[model samples]
Target: MTTLGHKSSMDHHLTGMSDNTVERPGERAPLVLNMDKFSQVTATVCRVSEAERAPIAWYICFTLSLGLLSVLGVCIGYLFLTGVGVWGLNNPVMWAYDITNFVFWVGIGHAGTLISAILFLFRQKWRTGINRFAEAMTIFAVICAGTFPGIHVGRVWFAYWLFPIPNQMEMWPQFRSPLLWDVFAVSTYFTVSLLFWYTGMVPDLATLRDRAKGKLQQLGYGLFALGWRGSNRHWHRYERAYLILAALSTPLVLSVHSVVSFDFATSQLPGWHTTIFPPYFVAGAIFSGFAMVVTLAVPARELFGLKDLITLRHLDNMNKVILATGCMVGYAYSMEFFIAWYSGAMYEKFAFMNRAFGQYWWAYLIMVSCNVITPQLFWFKKLRTSIPIMFVLSIIVNVGMWFERFVIIVSSLANDFLPTSWDSFTPTWVDIGTMVGAFGLFFTLFLLFCRYLPMIAMAEVKAVMPQADPHGAGAGKHGHAHH
Candidate 1:
């Protein structure tokens, strides 16, 4: 009787039930809204995957994605037949769209590990709503990012030599280059992220397996489920593995981008040679990453009728992150100029000046306006919460970030010490097609994932709801207690 009374009172407080009750200023709004029952959460998420046919929008988007993917394939085939000369590789501008796109996509993958591992460690319950697909985005983005370096090497057949392996020829990868560091860092990051993503999906996969009506569905989901029975022992192991992976992934979120920064920082080039690149790259990465999340989230929530699950609050919070990181990136931009001037080095000062007013000044201007100026609009609550505004702003943020890379790489390389050899770089049609094709690849995988997989981490979402409390009102009613 006492326990029941206690549970009822706690439930009342959690639910904000009393007419006179006022929400405290610091109290977080509910992460999941509407459809109070645990079963409702399960049914809503499952319906997207279980539907006999996806909505017409899915077909239209998928068709477009497939077309882009075909474009990517043709471009790659042409490039293999032709050469790296097919790109706009000029005298001084060897690294143009290829490196820029590589870094952009790698940065795009950062938000997943951040949302999943870092937020989970901090006990941020809101992460449960979006982390699943963010992780999927990470994997796909990495796949796109990885494509560049492989093909950029020119000798695609000899790409395997990038790895350290024994052979009759005794060829070994250069140990000193930061480029090699990227090989290890990105590959390790991908492996761990894949494991983390799959581990989180096990219980949810088991759910799909049990809910399967067809034999093939059962077998496919069951194969991946790995005998998840929801037993306490199974959960115990599951949680331990998850926590460990989260811990592992947190460092990776910091390390992967830092290593990527090393690609430029280790160089002797004036603008590229700076200590600030690590943190700057990481911040810009998270900034652009969250923007991509917003870009995808806005469409996803609306298309799938997930407005209640992925509420305005979620979008609002992500915009705030975008705003914060945008400030960091802006600060980094100013600091680069400050460092260049403060160092009393003519070459460094010239490098910074050239970026602002040099041949590629237009690119630099776009980078600053899009990356630094655009996100400031989020400071206003009304603007940040507006769906259409945030969507457009999110896309703009990515465009700015891409230009950020372009400005950093192309500007520095184009204006290297000897002005006599400097030449303007103009990308060929293959370059534009290849970059667009990478987008196609990313969306193709993502669309398929949404169609077949549990787009939400169903078990994780249930764990955060009020009814997950063992002593709550809904406890024991429908076996909704989180395992």
Candidate 2:
């Protein structure tokens, strides 16, 4: 079975997917992945390369991604080989890069799930184009965000100490400890996200199987597709499953970030204690997540010749979200400030003031300018649609969001209640290098995903297409209605 879909030299349906020369097991009906541009069961996998550089750009992006992953691997391995002493961490400041990086990555995970799950519930049909990729980003960013905390404990093998195993020593994990709570939260977050992402991939994998060329490709895609034929019955069940998943994910999104915030709020430490922490962390997570989505998607859209599919309209809509969430996050910052002063706690007052005018004051101001002020550009339609402007702003947002975590963690902890215990922390090259390396871990995986997986959710996209709604144009005339 050398059946190739696109007639390309490389991708032939070689090993896995055929019952005969011209017919398949379900040839009596239409195969889901063989759909046309207007397909009600498949997305338009027809990306145009005339105005974009798909392969060349892939080369460049993957190279950079691989380099970053290598750096991250070395940094982590070195952290273990040399011990925790390699980093700038000390007592009272023990939560430095470990916690900051955790929050930063977890925050990065929020936007993708929000865009896919929340917007879907709202009937925002436009999410079809980028939602698949965005969800994939959510899963991967969580993977990257999660790795740091595990290794940050210095004894990488003993990372399991965070968990309660009911072992021989009668050493129960402390229920009162926020760190233990973080263990439950992050593990649950990862499991839920994985389930959400994989369930969505099934229909898209069916599309890939139909589009496959060679026996090998066919077999590989066929297995991954899990025998999907996209019958009406399947779509009915699929849609139901998706809706249920969305409902389930909404709470997880809110709870995960809120729980992460509690890792700080539950602390008796001056800067760490705050009542508004949960909602504040959630807002910041969404804000940063959207910015990151914009940053990655802009490049992917341009490079992959998906301009029409990922139109400027999509960008404009995302800009609006980024602005809205950014504003909410900014308000959270203001609320923190107000709470600190209103509490009249000397330790709290000092923590807030020192963060602004102290040794690490610049990080705070940078966070303010980038997240609070820069997103204001979205007020202009021109800025919202302009790729160059969006690209720069997106990058700035990432930088600002990273600083938000840094300011919250490092600055707050650097100088605590005891003046004698106060000391400024700086990121060593290893810390900076490893942090930089995580980007590699992210991009490399993303690049591979785009090539193999249909970047668009084919079935979901088709389901939302105008004709897919049987009552579309014939509504009143035919005594029915469009979706």
Residue 391, candidate 1: C-alpha displacement in angstroms: 0.5
Q: After superposition, how far is residue 385 of candidate 1 from its true place, in Å?
A: 1.0
What are the lDDT figures for the candidates, one per model?
0.90, 0.78
TM-score of 2: 0.88
Model 1: per-residue Cα lDDT at residue 316 = 87
**Top of the candidates by lDDT:** 1
lDDT of 1 by residue, 21-84 (tens): 1234645456677655778888998899899999899999999999999999999999999889
Q: Which predicted model would earn the best TM-score? A: 1
lDDT tens readout by residue for model 2, 175-241? 8877777788888878877787888888777767786666877898789889999798988888898
Q: After superposing candidate 1, which stretches have Cα over 4 Å from the reference?
A: 1-23, 473-483
What is the TM-score of candidate 1?
A: 0.95
